[model samples]
Target: MRVEIDGISKSYVDSAGAPLHVVGGLTASIEQGEFVCIIGPSGCGKSTLLGMLGGLLPPDAGTIRFSGDRTATGEMTSIVWQDYALIPWRSIIDNVAFGLEVRGVGKQERKAIAQGYLETMGIGAFANAQPKQLSGGMRQRAGIARALASDPEVLLMDEPFAAVDAQTRTLLQEELLTVWENHRKTVIFITHGIEEALLLADRVLVLSGRPTKVVEDLKVPFARPRTADIAQTPEFGELKQHLWERLRDATRAAEWAEVEGANS
Candidate 1:
C-alpha cells in the first residue's frame, strides 16, 4: 500500500463550544498508484478527511502512513482545491511554477518545467495569459498543472471540478483520466457526486454522516479507459443503485441516532 489510514479520528469545537466528532476510527488503504474516490452525505467531514490525508491537518488520533518509495524530503503529496486557488496577478505559467520557485529553483528552470506541464495539460498556449482571462475549465487545468509540476507521489483532490458546469466537468474528468494514465500517481479524490466517483475511481469508499467511518468499500468492476457512456450500462446502474441504498441507510441511521440522542 502506498497509503494506509489506520483508525483515523478527528473532532472540532462546535458553535456552542461543544466537541463535535467528525470522523471516528476511519480505516482504509490505497495501493501504490491506485486511484480512490470518497463519497458521503453532506457535512460528513469529507473535506476534513482529505485535509488529514494530505497532512494539512493533524488527526486527534490514529495515523496516515505512506510506504513504497515515498520520501521524507520534498513534497510527496499535493492538493487540487475546489476553488482553483490561482494567483490572479500571475500568468498561468508563473502560477504553475509557484511551487518550484518557492523551493528556490531558478526562474528559468521553473518556467521550463511548468511549461512542460502546461503542454501536457493542453494549456501551453495560455502560459502567458492571466487567470482572469481563462474560462472556469481552463483555470482548473492550470490548477492541475500546478499540482503535477511538483511531481507528487499522491494527488489529493477535494471536489476539484465542483465549480464547473456539467459539460465542462465531464470534459475535465476526461482530462484527469488522460493525465492519470500518463503519471499513474496515487490519487485520493473527494466528491459528492456518486457517478463521478464511480467513473474515476478504482474503488469507491462511502462514508457515514457525522462521526463518519467507511460505510462501504466497493471495487469498481469496470475496465480502464472508461467513458461517460458506461453509466448507461446495466452493471453500472446496479452498482449505482446499491451505493445509493447504502448511503441512504447510512444517512438515515445517523439522523435517527441524532434524534434519539436529542430526545434522551
Candidate 2:
C-alpha cells in the first residue's frame, strides 16, 4: 500500500494547439493503509492526480510507484467515481460483482464476495433492485460496494458523495468512515469539500490551482470514528477554518487557470 508519487504532472493539448496543464510537479507519499484526501478548488486536477496514481492515466513528468508487498503495482485499486456509473440492466448484486467478474472470478464466488460488501455498504437490501430503483445516496453506496467487493488494497474515490443531497451526503460520509475503518485499505480520495476531507481523512493534501501541486500536506489529529458530532466541536471548526483560509487563496488563482496559455 506504500505509494511514491514523484514530480507528477499532466497536460492536455487544447483545440487551438496549446498545452493545458493540469497537475504540476506534485510529489507525495502514502504509507500502507493510510487514508489520504486531496482537497482543492474545483477544476484543480485532484482527480487527475488520482487517475495517475490509479494507473488509469499517465503523468507527463513523473512516476507513480508502489513499494510495498501488500499489493503488486499497488495492491490493485478500486475507484468510486462521482457518477454512480451503474449498469442499468444489472441488478444491484450483479453490479457490485462486476469488478470481480472482470478478473475471471466465478459467479458464485464473486456473488459471495459482493454480498459481503453490499451488507457492509448498507445496500444489501437493494441487491435485487435496479440502479434506477434506488435513490441517489443508495446508488452511490452501491457504487462503493462494487469497488470494495474486489478487496483491492487501494481505493481511489473521486467525490463519491458530492451528487447527493446535503443530509444524505452527511450520512454517506459517516458510512464511508465505517467502511474505511473496517477495511484499512490505503485510500486516496479526491474532494473539493474542505470539511469532508477533514472528517474523513487521516491526512489532507491541499492542491494549488491549475497546474496543480501540493500546497499543503497536513496530518489530521482527530481521533478515530469521526462523526458529525466532531464537526460541531472546537477542534473541527479550527481545522475547517484553517483549511478554508488556505483554499480561499487557491480559489482566486483557480480563475486564472482557465486562460488559454496554461493550455498553451
Candidate 3:
C-alpha cells in the first residue's frame, strides 16, 4: 500500500501547561512496498510520527491516507517496538498468534501461521518457550514474527533492533531484509543509526529539530540483498559521512533551540 502523509501535526501540553508541538506540517509520500527509513536528531518526533502511522496515535492536523487494497482482514498496519512488547505470560507461539486470534482465525490456523513465521525468523524451536526464557534478540525475533503473522499491509518499526547486541543486530538486519524481499510489505522504519538506515532503506527521510518536518529525503543508491560487505565500500563510507554531517548539523540546531527556550 502507498501512504500519503500531508501536513500532519501533533502536540501535547507540557508540565507548564504550554502546548508542546512535536510534529508540524510534516508531509511525505511512501510508495507501495517501499522500505523507507526515518532518521533525525533526538526528540525529533520520529516515534510520534510512527505512532500516528500505526493508528496508535491520531494526528492533530492534516491527513494520512493509504491507497490500495487492505492486504489482510486483520489490520492495515502493525508495529514492532524497540522493546519487543511481547507478552511475558504467553508462550512464544501464543504471542505470535495473538493478533490472528484477535481477528477470530481458528486456533489451528493461527497456530500454523504463527509457526511458519517463527520458522522464517529462525526461532521456530522456541515456539513453546515463555518470552522471559529467551534472550533479547530471540524475543525480538518473536516480536517480529508476531507482527508478520498478522499480515499487515504496512509495517511500522521503531528501532526494533536497538536493544540487541551489535552482532545480533547485524544478523537481525540481514534476516529482516530477507523477509522483506519475500513479503514485499510497505515498511516505515525509524532509527537513530544512519548506517542502519542506509543498509536497509530504499530511501531515507531526515527530519529537522522539534516541531519536526522532513528536511531531506535521500534515495539510497545501494542495491538490494545488501550485506555487511557493502559498508566496506568507499561509496558507502562517503554516504555515511554525508549522513553524519547532516545529522550533526540538525543536532546542533536542536541543542541551540533548547538553550534559547530555556533562556526565554
Best by lDDT: 3
**lDDT (Cα, 0-100) at 129 in candidate 3:** 100
RMSD in Å for all candidates = 1.8, 2.2, 1.8
- Please, what is the TM-score per model? 0.95, 0.94, 0.97
Residue-by-residue lDDT tens digits, candidate 1, 44-120: 88999988877788889988888933322348788999999999999999999999998899999999999999999
In candidate 3, stretches whose alpha carbon ends up further than 4 angstroms from where it belongs are 68-74
Residues 96-188 of candidate 3: C-alpha lDDT, one tens digit per residue: 999998899999999999999999999999999999999999999999999999999999999999999999999999999999999999999
Report clash pairs, candidate 2: 19-263, 20-263, 71-75, 261-264
C-alpha local distance difference test of each model: 0.91, 0.87, 0.93
Task: List the candidate 2 regions with Cα displacement exceeding 4 Å.
Answer: 68-75, 257-264
